[model samples]
Target: MKKNLLSIIILALLVVNIGMTAFMMLSVMTTNSQTAKLISDIAAALELEANGGNTGGFSGSASGNVGVSNIATFGFTGDDQLTINLKPGSDGKAHYMLVEVVFSMNTASADYATLGTSESLAGMRELIKGKVTNTLSSYTIEELQADDGPAKEKILEEVQELYNSNFIYDVTFSSVLYQ
Candidate 1:
């Protein structure tokens, strides 16, 4: 009777192990399939670019100047530059950061007409400065100093969220200096 009970327990354990193994295998297979699809999509996009195709709409590519090492500086945006001054969220040491922000846009943007005029541009600049200052003040010195950090993305998102009429395509930090 004891031998029969032991045999049953061993069989149950083996069954549970087999079930878990099957579940893991299925999950892996699903992940691999999705990865394959993503690779194909990326390949197709690259092929089109190589063939000199006008890939309409945002290409979802990084738009910034490649600076020394990995640091990027993007001050190439024609006449639309917004400079901001703020102190990063400091722990002890006092550090101030100067940020030159630029937005990439086309003629179709809603803010395009207003940006051309000095009066309207001034108004927009005020809005930008206010939003950017608020955004920048939230980041820590370490975050701002990183090569690729979440602070930049957060700043862009916050600024864009506040000014929807600006019709911003991409936000670039033209220049960043910390002192």
Candidate 2:
């Protein structure tokens, strides 16, 4: 009788251990699934922004100190009037895009002398064009086709990071076309 009781007790313990293991496994799986869902949402937002659906949805809120109207007056702008070809996305078709960008400057910032001066940027036109060309070539067609913007706003964002802080206070897209 004692042996039978011991047997029953051991079986119960085994069952409990198995149940606990299963429960832990399910808990871990649920957390992983939730994390994956969050990642998917963020990826969708990035894709939309790349296609221009949500321009400012991601990062860097605008500096209220710089207003939109000031772009033409104080901004240094660049235009890729010529069409650019981008890498094909999953669609596997040739993509063409044209973009015009307005880059703003802060008068109070130290970068003004170098990047704020329209004449200085004008002299660097070829360099700017090279940067744009390289940037555009890196994006996929679907990214440019979403409507009014290109992937990453690479032109404005990259230039600022590559040059100096506040050298680019704001970036405005004048025109964007994808086909």
Candidate 3:
């Protein structure tokens, strides 16, 4: 009787251990699968530039001179530029226009199209242009100069709305020319 009880206890313990190990393995597999899926999703969303090897720089100095590096090298992949004309404000001082913009889509192939389909890209371009125009119109020259935080937020919100996805990872001011 004693021997039978001992055997039953050991068997129960072994079964429990095996069950726990299997559960852990399954959990690990699930976690890894999810991670891989997330990585693929992000990669698809980025449409990462093939020429990420290219490093570009831009300077928005107080001197109103815009200097761009790598702009010429990369060339124009999509809509090349966004130019806005600002009217002098009511204060009679020519206020610098705040134009926030993103560079062209890094679409090297159909699989790497960041801006989605051509139709979506067209709509997004128009939406972005309109948003930038509207956001800039609201800011005075002083505000543009002083509060970069709000300006950046406005740009992000507009871009996110325009893209209809969180795909626009960043919004960079390609050029800030005050005329």
Candidate 4:
């Protein structure tokens, strides 16, 4: 009788351990699937924005009667126009102006063509916008339009840092209009 009871107790503990392990595994799998779905949704939204499906969806809330509109439109191949409405940042005493920038990839080389062939335009668009926004926000209007080559080089470097993918070689700005 003692031997039988000991065997049953051990079996029950083993069963419980197995059940707990299965539960943990299922939880991990569910979390991973949810993360993947979220990433997919973000990618789709970026693609839609890049392809010019809906520009108005990107707008942020207006503050102090100052609205910042994100007017983005696809231009020619490899080119995009982004209009940003600027408002005074916390300090209500700065001159706020809207800036519209049209940026394009310089696809004038054989290397560029090879890179373009490998990636979809939508992915490239997402990559470029992230790079441009990070780099351009630091400069004043005067610095961005400076005739000196260093300013342009700096911009390109910033883009390159963001995109280490071999598919992107250089970035060019076709237009920068400030209002």
Candidate 5:
């Protein structure tokens, strides 16, 4: 009789363990599905691809396709490099960034014919420098030091906005000095 009783107790515990496992699995699966749905919703809202492809950090304008032949580069170096006064950080000290930038423009754009030339670019030097200065000055020294991507992107966007076109598709900092 004791042997039978022991066997019954073992069977009961095994059944209970299986039931608890099923319950936990169902709970986890439900939560996981909900989280996945949330991520999909957010991605769709942002117009992001689910495959997670990178555009090589170059965001093309218009048709979202840029060819090598369509690219034109304008650079600021030497005396033309921007020396910007950055915003004060937590330490309340002044900071500066000396940055040499290069702009990759879409030569296929209509504005490119008007503004993409070296002489035309030189004529608009102050506007370009002002955009760079305003954008860089908004960031604290520490923030700018952490990652240069955001600053470059902001400058590109501002330049695009200034001209009411995305003729300038990319901005690169060939050299940077922070002090």
Candidate 6:
């Protein structure tokens, strides 16, 4: 009968469609799992957290939990903010940044007693400014703008080394403008 044959043909096509859909889903799921694993591996290798809180700038010798009560800040603002001429990028245009650098000192550290006060650190301000200038002027605008984490880490390291102490535990660019 023509009706019976047509029904059988339609049923066969539907069955094939269902089978193909299941196969495609299985293939896609396997690839998705593989991609997720690769991303996880890369994040772990870079010591990055999923929440993206830690930028690794305060790692190494200066890393520790300093309570808010034990923290002191010395900042460069207004006329004190640094104006750095950056290294030229591929575009070959001179770029500059106006940045305010702030140092977070650990008030509880022994070094703080000798060097952490505003008056004490002011004497070394020129030297610290030079270090910041040297670190920043070496990077091209593109490089510096891509991610500032490395630059901040380098400056923090140099400052700590300059004093031979970790009393200054963090450096922050509280304000910045690039042009």
Model 5 TM-score on a 0 to 1 scale: 0.69
Q: lDDT (CA) for every model shown?
A: 0.58, 0.63, 0.53, 0.48, 0.81, 0.84
Query: For candidate 2, lDDT tens digit of each residue in 4-70?
Result: 9999999999999999999999999999999999999999887665433533322232333555544
Off by over 4 Å in 2: 1-64, 67-80, 147-153
Best by lDDT: 6
Candidate 3 global TM-score: 0.42
Give TM per candidate. 0.48, 0.52, 0.42, 0.37, 0.69, 0.67
Structure candidate 6, residue pairs in collision = none
- TM-score-superior candidate, 3 or 6: 6
Model 3 residue 169 CA deviation in Å: 2.0
Task: State residue 69's C-alpha deviation in candidate 2, in Å.
Answer: 7.8
Off by over 4 Å in 4: 1-79, 85-114, 145-151, 162-170
Candidate 5, residues 1-179, lDDT tens digits: the string is 99999999999999999999999999999999999999999987555332122442223354355799998888788788888899999899999999898888888877789878888888888898888889999999999888878988788878877777667888889899999
Q: List the residue pairs that clash in candidate 5.
A: none
lDDT of 2: 0.63
**Candidate 3 colliding pairs, count:** 0
User: For residues 1-179, what per-residue lDDT tens digits would candidate 4 score against the true structure?
Assistant: 99999999999999999999999999999999999999999998876654334332211111112112412223223333554333334344333223333433334323345544435455676665555554555555554445424544555555444443322322344555554
Once fitted onto the true fold, the runs of candidate 5 whose alpha carbons sit more than 4 angstroms away are 47-72, 88-93, 107-119, 146-150
Model with the higher lDDT, candidate 1 or 5: 5
Superior by lDDT: candidate 2 or candidate 5: 5
Prediction RMSDs, each to the true structure:
11.1, 10.4, 14.2, 16.1, 5.2, 5.3
For candidate 1, write residues 79-174 as lDDT tens digits: 444434445454776666666676554445445566434465556666666766777776666767765246555555555555543334356777
Full ranking by TM-score: 5, 6, 2, 1, 3, 4
lDDT at 175 for candidate 4?
52
Please report the candidate that would top TM-score against the real structure: 5
Q: Per-residue lDDT for 102 in model 5?
A: 89
